[model samples]
Target: MRVGNWIKLSHLSAGFIAVLVGYTSSVAIIFQAAHAAGATDAELNSWMWALGIGMGISCIGLSLRYRSPVLTAWSTPGAALLATSLSGLTMEQATGVFLFSSLLITLSGVTGWFQNLMQHMPRHIAGAMLAGILLRFSMDLFLAMQTQWLLAGLMFLTFLLARIWLPRYTVPLALVAGIACAASLGLIQADGLAWFPATPRFMKPEFSWSALVGVGVPLFIVTMTSQNVPGLAVLRANGYQIPATPLISWTGALGVVLAPFGGFAFNLAAITAAICMSPDADPDPRQRYKASIWAGVFYLLTGIFGATVVGLFAAFPVELIAAIAGIALLGTLGNSLALALSDEHGREAALVTFVCTASGMSLLGIGSAFWGLVFGMSVHLMLRRSIR
Candidate 1:
């Protein structure tokens, strides 16, 4: 495909929103995790570099190869786990743990364990989990309205108007309207903006059983359950039929390669990927891969800029970010909820999944998304048995 033919404004908007939401949502957790591991400013920059570049490379390569919107992301839940569990470990030890966890992930993919698990996942249940995961952002839109009413209201109204008038241009219009509104309100800050380029700094790994079992194992589990599973669910729910094993394997392998440079963990993205996969991204599903490619280009720039990207994103007001995310994902959220409740037999179980996952409750160091799936599937099985 010619570059000129493939590129579209809608595709570019999808990619921009994916990066914006991805960065604003959970980047603080990544910062916290780095701090816990005693990472210096340079090391933190390295982490961003590794993650952004890894995602960029994987996303571009996979999407081009498969002609599908295959986006990769750093594991947010894993980073959250690391923030709490990595207090005692040196940066070197933390790097070692990342390597260990990635090895396990690679092994799972290579052996087809991850792919098999995804294959058995029922569609309604997957849709419910996705809806649950995204509920917080949707809620954020309203919560921002409480504090920044004008900003939120305008963005929301813009989204509504665009949906009615332009249809395919809804998210882009909303995003532009929100930013313009924020600028008018003087909500964008320039306090931390700088021109420092990102440089990768490598730390030598120091392996230990304690670090391996405590940090590495939990990271692997969380990344698999909370990140990769939901990611695949988002893809499948959105009508993509891409293979799972290769995606998982490549993510893990890339994670291993970049671990020494402070890349903690990598997996498929759920929420941001949904943006690229949604109808609002592009009316034609065949052209959605262009959005993924654009996202990769943005990721590559973000990686090259590293810490500067964080500050630049931070400059955008929280309300604007939340509003844009909620608006961008509205179409996706609606579709997920609709599909999740479409099957009469699965409706109740899907509802349970949606409620639990949306509750954001974490137990036994695992996120609500995982528990929701388990509970929903159990209920689904019980209902089938009762009917029999």
Candidate 2:
């Protein structure tokens, strides 16, 4: 198909918003992670470069191959883990940990172990898990209104009106409204913004037993449970049945190649992926892959101009980003809840999943998503036997 035939204004907007939201959300944690390992300014830029390039290639390649919106992101939880754990380790040893964790991910994907495990997850459970994961972002819409009442309120009103009249462009219209309000109120800060291209700085890996055991093992666990699990659930909840094996395999492979350049871990994205898969991206689900493709294009630009892109995103007000992300994901959050509660047999279990996931509970370094699934599935099985 011709590019003009598949791409639309809505697709471009969705793509841009996905990249914007991804970067603005947890980028600070990434900086902390870099600093924890004693990285210099050049090495920090290389980290962003490697992660952007890795996510860009994987998203574009996988989405085109499957004709679905396949979004990838750096491991936020992994970065958080490193931020606290990497203080004692050298950058070289940290690189070794990244490589080790990535190898485990690659083995899981190549052996089809992770995909097979996810296949056993029920549809309702998956929907509930997805809804739970996105609940915070959706709620941030109103929370943002509290701080930047005028800006967020105008964006919310615009979204509602656009949804009725311009269904496909609701998100973009809301975003524009928010930006205009922010600009008028002097919320947008453009100071210190300049074009700075990123250059890759490679570090040699030096393996150690302590780093591998303490950091590598935990990184792999969180990347799988906290990141990849909900990411796959987002795809499945939205009725995209693309195989998980290739998605996992390719991301893992890219992580291995880019780890030396400060790409700690790569995994499928949940929140940003939902933006690309939402109906507002395209009325036709089949063509929604174009959103992810455009996101990949933006990701490439972000990598090429790492510092510039970082400063650009930093210029937007936090409230604007929160409101826009919430408005864009409203449809997806609603659909996930509907699917989760549609079946009377699974309604209670699904609700359990949603509640647990939304609680944001974390234990033993594993996120609430995994625990929610486990608890929900257990309740489901027990309820089934009792009914029988």
Candidate 3:
């Protein structure tokens, strides 16, 4: 427990950015999903509580066991799907679907379905999808400049200068610059800020074929295809050899344990995981897991503070959030795109995947990530057949 040995400023900075980016990007969608399922203010607090606790425990526990950064998150795409599909379902029915989805995820891990699925996925295609998923955030870094030119422009310059001068501290420096700029502009909102603890509110489960088919099944599919698949790809792309089954199992079990309190679908994290796994988190790859452990500590604090934590993050201007996230992910995005198109044969297919995923199209309730994989694989198979 020597502070000097385990603690690094870079690791702490990475962990903080990971949580900050995660909340700023899609927490609104999560709030929408909870409300769609008839969640009250208290229930919404419980949902945040469950999700934060689950992520914190799994990130710390799994990373320590495997000695690698194994970050986990509630399925963002799954939450988006629920926001649309859970419109008419009662809270009890929604809880049932949550439980059912967790069961499927648990089985996927326990039975090695996740590993089997990953085994068949091409590395190039995975990289393509990862790049595609991240491209928008990269664009956002510049897009933020359109509205808040002063704030974002300063951040972009700060990021470039930090990369040149400080390297490992690039993101942290840019974040500080963005926040300082935001505050100077009077963009930070502090209304209704108060301390409060997260309290769990349970809903009794109710099952029906309608809820199962309409909600549970689609949630399972989206969580796996959109979140877990890309998540595993992030791990593989980073040269981690941790077993996928155990990681999946642990996340699924945690999801199930917290479902009654509104933990919907838990799975491996991709973008945030990239932040922790990147070299900016630590100089030595072996030490990067400590970044995830720190992220866990932040998540635990968020859970303990409940709605106050949400409000705290929400207080930051959107442009600042976008600027910081774009800066944080630049390294991982560059590496993914480079590796994806490196092979001559896979180049075209990977491009197709990248374009499709970056397009952010949704059809039939499935997100762009899944469709990107489909398009990429199809093009790859066709190219191989033509060559033969």
By TM-score, the best candidate is 3
Runs of candidate 1 exceeding 4 Å displacement:
1-47, 60-105, 165-169, 199-245, 259-297
lDDT of 3 by residue, 229-258 (tens): 778889999999888788878888888899
Clashing residue pair totals per candidate (backbone < 3 A): 0, 0, 0
Q: Please, what is the TM-score per model? A: 0.68, 0.66, 0.70
Judge candidate 3 against the unseen true structure and give its global Cα lDDT, from 0 to 1.
0.81
Between candidates 1 and 2, the TM-score winner = 1
As a TM-score, model 1 comes out at 0.68
Candidate 1 lDDT by residue in tens digits, 1-388: 5777767888998998888767755675577689889988889899999989999999899999998899889987677557656776799889999999999899888998776655666678877876775666667788889889999899889889877888655666776787788889888898768988799998999998777875686577668866888899888887888888888899999999999998889999887898898887888888898899899999999899998966665677878766776665566568779979999999999999989877766665455656787799999999989989
Q: How are the candidates ranked when ordered by TM-score, highest leading?
A: 3, 1, 2
RMSD of 2: 6.3
